[model samples]
Target: MSHHLASLMVAGGLDALTYSSLAFLIASGLTVVFGMLGFLNVAHTSFYMLAGYIGFSIASRTGSFWLALLLAPPVTVALGLAAERLLFRRLYAAGHTPQLLLTIGLAYVIAETTKMIWGDDSLALAPPTGLGGHVVILGATLPVYHLFVIVITMALVGLLALLIGWTRLGMVVRAAAIHPQMVDALGFKLSAVHTFVFLVGLYLAAVAGVVMAPMLGIYPGMADDALVQSFIVVVAGGLGSLPGAFVVAGLLGLVQGFGSVFLSDYALYFPFVVLAGVLLVRPLGLFGRGGA
Candidate 1:
């Protein structure tokens, strides 16, 4: 390829990776909750948006991005835990419709409350010190913060793999995902496991929100866009498959990044098209199985 073409390709590739990283972070939680708990949380992205606003507030007050990073996720987790304990716990046996409706209502509440508190204007959160510069990659200038996001995502992926593959909690979670009754019969606390998994999912979303705030900005309807993209990733990857979500997120990122350049007018529909194509070929998704 010519130098210009090569640079464009490199830039697009980097953009794709960054997008994939963010999607994975957001979708992994959604997948995990669905896989393990069988509960669909339509309000998950609202938690993400809420955490971003909280992080912004914390950073603004403390003048410490590090502090916001440290604290915002826990606050998100607290709210998630409250929702699980107070609302979701009572509805586990009520089926999907009620849960879906409840979550939708929760999303609206969060959106309106956020607007009331923070106003409707978009807010910017700067990257941490030393991450605001540009770096040259194959003659392509890229934001250092984008690279940081990619690296952090990779680290979190490894951490998740280790958490889900090797530990005792992981074993119990895996068992519960497939057969909660059997796990419960074996003396594991299903309720506790469900709560933990739900909180973990929220924690992941909060991390993505805080980390991605610099790139995406905090806005009133930010959660809507994220929710749409995340739902696409989850459904396209398979309802409850983390590995599938990761792969699909990468595929989606590439489609979006390049599509925006080459098919600007139609780029908005590209993800839905990819989702449709994937479902048409493999109804169960790329890596989906009968259970978690």
Candidate 2:
């Protein structure tokens, strides 16, 4: 291949990696919450989109990215808590179809609420001053914002790993994931633990939104596609497996990123193809255990 062709290929590969990181960021939270709580949070993507809108609003009004970064997640956490307490708690004993229907209804409610509040116009978030330019790497120029996003995502993933592996709360979460009945038997409040897990998932989704807003341009239905994509990641990675979600998210992101270049309009369906194949081969998912 010509030197220029080689450079373009390398750049495309890096871009794919960048995209995968975003997918991982979005998917990890969904995987953790779903895996631990055994509840499919169909409204999770709304939290993601709400984060972007919240962050954008704050940043635009105050011109302080730091404030937006700090504020959005907590707001999302509160929302998650409200949903869990008011809606999800009732659905815990309900059948899967009812639980799913409730969540799906909640998703529509959130989307419509967002539209009512933010309008249908697309909104763009300005990158922080430090990440507002471009950087050249390996004879290719890439957006500094995207590089920052990749770094932040890696740090978030590492932090999540540490939280799950080292902290007391993490221990409870892990225990709940592995043996919820046992955890409750041991005197831990299952409701409290699930609430915490749900909040954490919402926070993660919010962070993903804040980071993605600059790239995706926040809009009313911004999270519609993301909801489906996250489901694909969760199922592909094996439901409830945090590490599996990361691996599958990365794979899907890479496939979509590179496939889009070649397949153009059809790239959106690439992850589904991989998902179908994986399900056929291993119905349990890449890392999902048959139970728990």
Candidate 3:
């Protein structure tokens, strides 16, 4: 292996773009629920972690990453809907503190349940047939899977932007976020909208885990790592701003990716440094209306 500083930096940039996309997928769910629903659900990352494990299992048993990718999101979405009816619905009026506690406890439960099912070992899956290769970029080797992840996530961003920005359903979602009571008073069932949004969030998390399962591996501790990233993205992007989530995700991804290559010894701390700097410069985050 030879060191090429410029090629290394480009590699880092590709890594950043891929990572930021995955983070955005996971964090978007958290931001949507927190920003639009006005309640913090810390257990969201559990869905992401669980999806990776589940998708891995499916791929292992069936030898088909395609099936795993298709099946995982719906399964996770179903679980989210169940949580809404059986657990989260009760917490709607309990405010953030109780919601936080309940979700924290739920996160533990999900983690433990995952342990019982998957054991404590970390698991990896092979990328889908077409994605398992390498591509050359700027005199450096880039994983084809990384570029694939970026394209899929970008497609998702476009789909979400269109759905939330133009559709009637999106109008209802925005209305619910801004004024739930008014939406309910206007003859639309707000609970359904809430359930839909929550499921969308969970689905997104599952999709992220499924797509990145090969890169990130599967383990019980994955949820905690994801939660930390989610918190940063949510805080940095501003609460309730999906567009902000996209920007912040990309920013943090680049910061961490390049920071690791340039400051390898301090790579672990670089992300937090970026977060702190962003906070100091604008406590409200880049697009947030106010600090959390």
Count of backbone collisions in candidate 3: 0
Model 1 gets an lDDT of 0.88
Candidate 1's clash total is: 0
Flag clash pairs in model 2.
35-240
Model 2 agreement with the true structure over 212-236: per-residue lDDT tens digits: 8878889887687888788888888
- For model 1, residues 1-292, the per-residue Cα lDDT tens digits are 6887777788888888998998888888888888777788899999999999999999999988889988999999998888888888887888889999999999999999999999999999989999999998788888999999999889888887898799999889888988989999999999998888888888888989999888989999889998898888888888688888988899988988777766779988978988998889988788777543
Candidate 2 C-alpha error for residue 48, in Å: 0.8
For residue 84, what is the lDDT in candidate 3? 77
* Error of model 2, residue 229, in angstroms: 0.3
Ten residues in sequence with the least summed lDDT for candidate 1? 283-292
**TM-scores, one per candidate:** 0.95, 0.93, 0.95
Which is superior by lDDT, 2 or 3?
3
RMSD (CA, Å), candidate 2 to true, equals 1.9
> How high a TM-score does candidate 3 get?
0.95
Model 3, span 18-74: residue lDDT tens: 989898999998998888778798999998988888899899999999999999889
Q: In lDDT terms, which candidate is top? A: 1
Pick the winner on TM-score between candidates 1 and 3: 1
